[model samples]
Target chain A: MMNEQRREFIKKTALGVFVGLGAASGLVPAFSLEKTALPVWDEKPVPGKIRWGMLIDTRKCKEGCQQCVAACHHEHNVPAFKNRREEIRWIWKNSYKNVFPTADNAGASKEIQSRTFLSLCNHCADSPCTQICPTGATFKRWDGIVEIDYHRCIGCRFCMPACPYGSLSFNWQDPRTAIVDPVTAYPTREQGVVEKCNFCSDRLIKGLQPACVEVCPEQALVFGDLNDPASDIRVLLESNVTMQRKPELGTKPSVFYII
Target chain B: MKSRKLLWLVTFAAISLFAAFYLFSNGEAETPQKPLARVSVVDSTKCIAPKEFMRANHMQVLHGWERSVVRDGDRVHIASNGSRFQKSLGTCLGCHNNRLFCFSCHSYANVKPKCWNCHLSPMETQ
Candidate 1:
């Protein structure tokens, strides 16, 4: 009888101790939970108030000049592969006809007609890539930028087909060994994951311009808050006739071009 | 004959009870393997969270960070103490670059995480 009473007491005490330990670990703040920090934003954009947009003036773009493209690729440490299929590109130059194959035009200046066009991720407002990503790897930020989380991407390639513009590139091989001098700061992509331009979210956090925008010799690229009527891109769009790639699809490309 | 049957049942019960006690009590004497040593840290005196909590819940934290930042657009994480931290790899890379510590313990435990599919260790760049 004494042994039975002792056993019952021990079981209750054990249960109480287990419950207490669980509650303590879960509800109480863990040690070193204080003093969490992030980079101080000198100019933090108010969420929902700022819509980042870029305006490209094709008239000012110099023919065959790839300064902006090179800067963007180099800055992002985009891996260059001889196999075109394996190439990782942030920005590139193409002919105007190829870039805007659907546009109709008559007798124009050869210089204007033959001008090199810059192509990149449009960062569509209703981005199809983000909509189709199963893992939610590709998502649109509140500031109108289509962002990708590399860790979350499962390389399903659903986003690849969902993208109207051929922007997202899959790394076929380990990109670490391909580059001669790798930019250490930028994370290297592994095989079987997709990547694309994010409009320089890292630089944006630091209150700096995108590498391509800063590298333009003609000052052709204008980036600003499209939501604000007083912003440069808004003013430029109001004054000039802006054309976006495949506007009929209604993706609402944030990057605009003026002919 | 009835006494003989009772004796056999008693012997069997005693053997079973002895086996259970031995099996259950053996764990108390077993020593757990040492966790991997800490890798190079900028400030070894500090950690982002408590050592035991981090050791147990790091993978969960990163997984939550993915949903919080990408899907929900919650970029800044406010700790219980009201301090803010950005959900980023820079925070982890700043301390444990994962070259020595992460791989060592993970390999020992035979659990391979897929973070390297898109992220490089800081040591790899150098």
Candidate 2:
């Protein structure tokens, strides 16, 4: 009996010491060593299996088609407004100079005046938007996809000014009233909230291509895991002279464009 | 007795004055003059339908556009000529352009049909 009481006392004293140490160091509350396993879903992308990315082959992309843009808007239920001020876009085409200003200026001596390119969220490995967001609403997932949780956004617009690519947008008006029947694929955002491209996280979970990728007739868009040397994106990176947006900013964007 | 009464009255007045000042100042400090945020309300009754259509698609209208039209219930009415309408976008742009708030999504969606296609994009692409 006495031995058992001594053992109990020792255990209680040890636990108290651990808790005190944790509190002093600001570590999480101490708990027992028993490991609790999380339930695994059959469809869950094996935690690090797929790193979503995009490669734009400007050579194959036809100017003015805007098919990718239409498909993305249609799928996401983006509103169409007549006023330029009320317009919203996820992906759009720009003149070669717009997409690649540095390269375009360098190529001014060359003969191609009609060269055009597509631009969207670069989904950088070192994303500035994620760092600047006061609320952790914007974040990069484990698989290298930058995403936003609309619920946590406070509409501070700090991320807007921080982003060099101008990929973010704020809901000046309540978005619920804009569309006939808002697309139910994703939750609609409220007024005074900021939003941006999430690389279509919902579609990725289903093992499907991004809306833009599915609709590109010219096959100008490529999506894959960049970490794997065997992946198609990796192969393309090896073969093509592709460049990222704003390398000087050191964002290291996953989206690459072949010149 | 008179001196005692005067001292007591002076003390009471001082106490009352301090209490009043504290109460009023605290009340004013606690009540914010401007709210942290202002959500625009839609006036549905004053909304104007598109000229081509009797009613504009719900998505086509700006936020707070239909607030004036909302009656006792969910039902709303629109003007026959589709000319005069209250709009949240208009109110928002009174101080700033809609491009700051809308362009990223508009460009992403690529739904530029009427004014968007013809008007200059705010984004200064090279």
Query: Which candidate's lDDT is highest?
Result: 1
- Model 2 chain A poorest 10 in a row by lDDT: A32-41
The residue-by-residue lDDT of candidate 1 on B31-125, one tens digit each, is: 22222222121222245577778889988988887676555555555455554556666566555533344543454346888776555553354
Q: Looking at model 1, how many pairs of residues clash?
A: 0
Minimum summed lDDT over a 10-residue window in model 1 chain A is located at A27-36
For model 1 the local lDDT of residue A108 reads: 46
Q: DockQ for all models, in order?
A: 0.07, 0.01
Per-residue accuracy of model 2 over A1-259 as CA lDDT, tens digit each: 6435644564677744432332233232222111111111122122334456899987788867889987876667565655666555667777766666555365443434476677888888777788778777776665667776664678888988888877777777765556444443344556677776768765654446899998999898999877677778889989998888778877778899886
Predicted model with the maximum TM-score: 1
Candidate 2 stretches greater than 4 Å from native: A1-49, A108-113, B1-126
* Inter-residue clash pairs, candidate 1: none
TM-score of model number 2: 0.54
